[model samples]
Target: MITENTIAAISTPLGRGGIAVIRVSGKDAIAIAERVFRSSHGGEVRKFPSHTVHHGLVVAPNSQEPLDEVMLTVFRAPNSYTGEDVVEISCHGGVFVSQKVLEAVLEAGARLADPGEFTKRAFLNGKIDLVQAEAVADLIQASTERSHQEAFQQLRGGLSDQINAVRNSLVDMLALMELELDFSQEDVEFLDRQEIEERLRRSIEELDKLIASYQRGRFLREGAKITIVGRPNVGKSSLLNALLGMERAIVDETPGTTRDAIETQLDIKGVLFRVIDTAGLRQAKNRIEKKGIAITEFHIEDADVVLFLLDASEGVTRADEKIWQQVERLSQKRREMFPAKIIIVGNKIDLGNQLTKGSFDPEMGKWPLVLVSAKTLTGIPQLNETIFKAVFDERWERGDAVITNVRHLQALQKARQHLGFALETLKQGLSTEFAVVDIKGALEQLGAIVGQTTPEEVLDRIFEQFCIGK
Candidate 1:
């Protein structure tokens, strides 16, 4: 494994917790650790076997004063997270004490680690792929059970296995294509054109599914956007508060109470949804309200799911009809995918005036209408289920790998495009060398997802987004 200068950073969050872990990794991790740590066992840090733990006290350099009691763990090279010698000091979690401990370690010949340096080193040293490295961040930031599960699975090589399977197929095909190129001068056909065409077609289909899976995958990664929109005093804000179980949006009887979009998070069935409560969709009476309407239109155009709130106490009125027209017109650019599905909501069902499929024009009637009373939260459980069913259908079967990263999705699309070109070359009876070029392009694109061919700048951008010492 590759080794570099010793780098140390607090692996745990800096605060007044029960304890914190300081990570040291590189060629001299154990040696630097020994300088600042005096083990109770009274042996050199390097002498301890790999994966061994010991009690120690951090000693200040120059003054030789004890800093704090800690438990030091040693990991020898070729077996550590970075595939290099590593040392971990579990110290008391205090703002001042952790700082002092880190300072002592830095003074003991260890350099301060940059953001994500530890995880970056793991990727650079071949301990993990780029997808797994990104998964580390996702796992750390996961807010719901579904997000956590996806990230954990990705880290455990679920996505990597899928990527490698597709990549191997391309590799096998490319080898044969190159072999065919070699036999071109001999007037011998080493590869069958029909077989190559069939294989390319299958590979393209596999890529298409992964690309399509990005819709739900993105929702799992970054919560879904659910915009509640309707005419004045249709209980949009109340619905938002009801769903979030908190008064996140101000509820007022007066119209245009919310002049701007108020966004809050709601977790339904382990999937996150960003519920946005916007100004009632109506003719603006002021400049601020006009801007709010524009903002509402924007949200409607891009929302994953829209809650078209209609007052169930009263049937659809002219104002509701006008707002529905604007919403339909603005949603032209919305994604035609599972996450883009909408559910029409009729609030104030406690008034015993819930609407049905016969309540609106035929076009509006095509959408599912759910009745609820935001004031009493009646039918909220049904509303949650309706919202969830709108995006995630039975298609979300287990073991079907879905890519959550946009970068991975783009890479797959570009790889699929190259493969498309390869199939075209074969179908057109083009030269073997042309197909070889296309296949190579596809290989590089696929390799970039797993970091085999990723550029340095792209790596920098990705790792810089990670937390320091992870």
Candidate 2:
């Protein structure tokens, strides 16, 4: 698994900072580094001990010319990130200085590293599996705290351990079924039928749990889309402003002041929510208004949650009923395609407790009824709690393994399908050979997730998403 050529790149972001690192890896890394680096102690980089840092000056190989003063750290073979002979040069941060150091390394004999080549090499060298390798990218691109925590857990082999546990059970069951297949002609049964069924059931249950976590995992990874909709002048904009703790949307006394969707992001309890304040639902007076209303409806269709605001002071009116009817029709139409949670929010409660126990009573428990005064910022915390509870489970902990990557989710789904097929075949008293086929299929799918049997093209595509020198 050793790579032939040495690779080098600026590991840090290219900008003006206190320092920037240039990483060199592969069999010839130390040799290439030694060619250009002259230690302050007058020793070659090759003689440096593993995990030791040395003060050095990078010089040109052809002519003795100092390029930059740097701190060179050496990591010997099988001990570095790429599991190769690695040298990391920490140089003064500057666009030109970092480039000069990288150029010196390349001139000394190392090739320019491709995007994600470092992580790809780690995967190829058996230092990490595909799940952990993908987690490297996830950790880097994580925007929110929850995403960061999930990525860190995945990188620490949390998701991989869970997948491998199920995979092991599947493998054991497959072995037993194969053993029984060898004695198909005899009446003797090597494995109990009920035992095989139970094993398959457990494996399927594990897969199902992982699959179920994807929805919340995805919301954590990529923020949830929340659309706020109501009739004109119902304080929709005020609620958006209150939720974000800023005046993002314009509040006006005139109805239909906001004829377009205004979007912003808010993080609630480590989970990111992309909130959209749409134009009020009403009879459009102009062509522009009509287009804006259409966009609002479109956002509703695509929203993960809808905050249907009502004026508590005025109570539910005929216009509000008409809007509810439209919402119901849309929900029915998009029940399969767009399954969004609708929370009825009673706004302007600070004006007075004018709301009566009518069609939209808080006691009915039909939909989540949250009372809030966007003007005074009253009951906002409760609204936030309701929103958080709508999407995530109360029992889920931060360290729990969540399937955030779409690739992992797809692999789990394929494995679940095969496991279901295997279970069905076993229950029907089919030939052991038939069940063995599905079991093998399930095993292969699971193996792909952890890089035991992944295709080269799939690996290439996954690593390609990563930046260079990762």
Top TM-score prediction, candidate number: 1
Name the 10 consecutive residues with the lowest summed lDDT in model 1: 331-340
lDDT tens digits, residues 147-185, model 2?
Answer: 889988999999999999998888877887787778777
TM-score of 2: 0.95
Provide the global lDDT of candidate 2 against the true structure: 0.88
Per-residue lDDT of candidate 1, residues 1-470 (tens digit): 47568899988887799998989999988888878888887988868999999997999976889999999999997899998899999999988888898999899899999889899999999999999999999999999999999999899999888888888988998887787677778887756899888888988998998898888788899998999999888898889989988888888999888899998899998999998898888778889889999999999988988889899889888888888887776665655544256688999888868477887878789888888999999989999999998878676786678899899999998999999998998888887688888888988998999999999999999999988879
Where is model 1 more than 4 Å wrong at Cα? 334-339
lDDT of 2 at 295: 94
Per-candidate TM-score against the hidden true structure: 0.97, 0.95
